[model samples]
Target: VFALVFAVSCENSNVKEEPKKEEFRPLIVRKDGQYIEYYPGHKQIKMKGREDADGNRAGIWKLFSQDGVELSITVYTKGKKDGHIVVRYPNGMPNYVGEYVMDERVGEWKFYAETGELLETIVYDEPTKENK
Candidate 1:
């Protein structure tokens, strides 16, 4: 049959498959030296961060909105979130400022309105420290 003939010809010719111009890529993937990643089905960047050779997140990472606006900035130490953190509203104004101690929120955390007005303040008890 024609199908059998075509299969035999392809095997003997060693024809390679052609690749498409636009290949599909995942929105989020963990790979060494990958510093930028997009959200699902979005063209704009969703997060920006760097990974060590061991595939651990290091240093600072930025999260973005679908509109490509920065929504949060978090610091990482040896793959753990630590240090200061900031989250913003859709308007790009800061929504909150807080600190992370060894991946846990601690100390005073201040929240703000979209208009840069302070809404509330919260103090998280340090989990590592005994409550007085």
Candidate 2:
């Protein structure tokens, strides 16, 4: 988990604020550790993940709604999505679950209904004769 430390400042807000101009949102700032993004004008974590020293995504990243419901989860390797990802409905039901290899979807992917019934299955990568 990323410990909130520094206050992020918007890169575009370096100039003096003009009364007529719209305010800019803060930019994400990090220092070779977990990254946590807060909701605009709020303190709740909108997204959180860890990154390598060079800024490459290193592990699982999770996104949440403003009220703290998990929206989706994805695993990354060197900034590329390389594992399972599950996206959920607003009510927190799993909408779809699939796997990724090197940022590409692979194997069987399943979609479900809000009632928790399987709706469909799609094979992203068919088995080859050698693998069969």
Candidate 3:
């Protein structure tokens, strides 16, 4: 009964709201070549550490091709790639997905073709005498 009443009240509420949009605050560069490529057709692209008001890069950053196909999706923790980074083919199909440690491949990395077929798997392991 309370739920029904609350639902009706919510439907009649006159609250104007805006959908949350991803924010892209440009980083100020003191040196040359320090800007993230946030759009497609961006040649000679370079990226610098993005920061928040408190100076943190805890946001989503993407790269694209000239045809507007998403090339990569990388998330940063304190300005380093500390999460899943996805790379796609120019045709927009997934090319690779894996874990990264400070932008270095650290775990299982899977590669796929433009048609979504598995292409390969890469595992990082130190060379052992027996395996060598």
Candidate 4:
């Protein structure tokens, strides 16, 4: 009957709509080799990660700038950074090279001059200590 059909449609309409899922955020390559989202993005941005068959980040990741420049190339192992991580200047010269442990600077770091010369070396024996 029309009444039965109307009642059924009304009940269906009363069903709650599913909540929208949160957008995928970019993974922050931590020194512990874990990929966690450290920041949020507004648009659909491409991301890269070293993933195992289980789809967890297990190695290096290279994140690109929205303009397609290599923004940062980071290392990871079992989701932790354990090796050289390099970031470049817009012109592609070395911006930073250093070691990390659990996302903290824990070793020697060298900076290069814009002219491509070694600028300085900083040795970190402790997170709060620096020897230049």
Candidate 5:
């Protein structure tokens, strides 16, 4: 009976516990016309952006990685992605730079290596009817 109880306790101890879920609080409104979001426990800034009076995303929006590094910067117009969109590596180096016109990718999109070297440039063509 002693051996059986010890084995049961050992089995329970070996079971992995589920990770606790992190709860995200609401965006803190800033007087500068931007909204800021924070991480659950640390309360570190996760994102900062502005929205139109209609609650649509407008102007430049920046999203951060969990480590608090800027992950991407997207330009929005009236709720659609427009103008330049820049995504960065965790180290804050530009990973990709592309342009969007009225929500569709236009012109050349440049991709970079993690070391900040330009890898390739992909030119986007107008969407054909079949491709659309």
Candidate 6:
């Protein structure tokens, strides 16, 4: 009887356990005529912006860090980057500011130090058709 009980316990110990499933929730929603997306578990907002009728990113979009801090602001037209873009450090200081034309960087781009001082500026020339 002791041998039989020992064998049963060993068999049970060898049994495989199923993996746990991760929880996921929908992120996108429509609020006040705008479409917004939230982070998993609804802990914080991930992005808020407008989407075209075809569900493409349009107008201005703001993305946030996992901690709910604004990370970047970008303007999109038909899912393509256009207009001005600003990216910030995790500490909420501006890291860079630049403009885009049809997904191509244009004009002058400004970089900032962590102290919010201007670091450097770069000028981007228009791309030629051959190089584009």
Query: What lDDT tens digits, residue by residue, belong to model 5 across residues 1-132?
Result: 999999999999999999998775555655456677777655578888898887778999999988888899999988888889999999999999998876888888999999999999988888322134
Among all candidates shown, the one with the greatest lDDT: 6
Give me the runs in candidate 6 sitting further than 4 Å from their true place. Answer: 1-25, 30-33, 127-132
For residues 1-132, what per-residue lDDT tens digits would candidate 2 score against the true structure?
133322234444566765796567564646559888888775578988999878888799999999899999999999888889999987899999988887777888899998778999989765322131
Taking the tens digit of each residue's C-alpha lDDT, what string does model 3 give over 1-132?
999999999987867788998665433342232345433333434343355555556556676665666788888776667778898888888999977665556777899988999999988563222121
RMSD of each: 8.4, 14.9, 15.2, 8.9, 9.6, 7.2
TM-score for each of the candidates: 0.67, 0.70, 0.50, 0.50, 0.67, 0.69
Say which prediction, candidate 1 or candidate 6, comes out ahead on TM-score: 6
Residue-by-residue lDDT tens digits, candidate 6, 1-132: 999999999999999999989776678888554887888788899989998887777899999999988999999998888889999998899999999887888888999998899999988888322144
Off by over 4 Å in 2: 1-27, 126-132
Residue-level error in angstroms, candidate 6, position 116: 2.2
Checking candidate 2 for backbone clashes, the offending pairs are none
CA error at residue 71 for candidate 5, angstroms: 1.3
Which pairs of residues have clashing backbones in candidate 5?
A: none
Model 2, CA-based lDDT:
0.81
Alpha-carbon shift of residue 128 in model 4 (angstroms): 5.4
Better by TM-score, candidate 2 or 1? 2
Model 1: worst 10 consecutive residues (lDDT sum): 123-132
Q: What lDDT tens digits, residue by residue, belong to model 1 across residues 34-90?
A: 678887775798998988777777888999999988999998887877889999999
lDDT of 4 at 11: 97
Candidate 6: the clashing residue pairs are none
| lDDT measured at residue 78 in model 5 versus the true structure, 0 to 100 | 88
For model 4, residues 15-119, the per-residue Cα lDDT tens digits are 999999987644454334334333345342335665665556567787665555676778766566766788777667787788877566777888886566888
Q: Measured by TM-score, how close is model 4 to the native structure? A: 0.50
Ranking by lDDT: 6, 1, 5, 2, 4, 3
RMSD of 6: 7.2
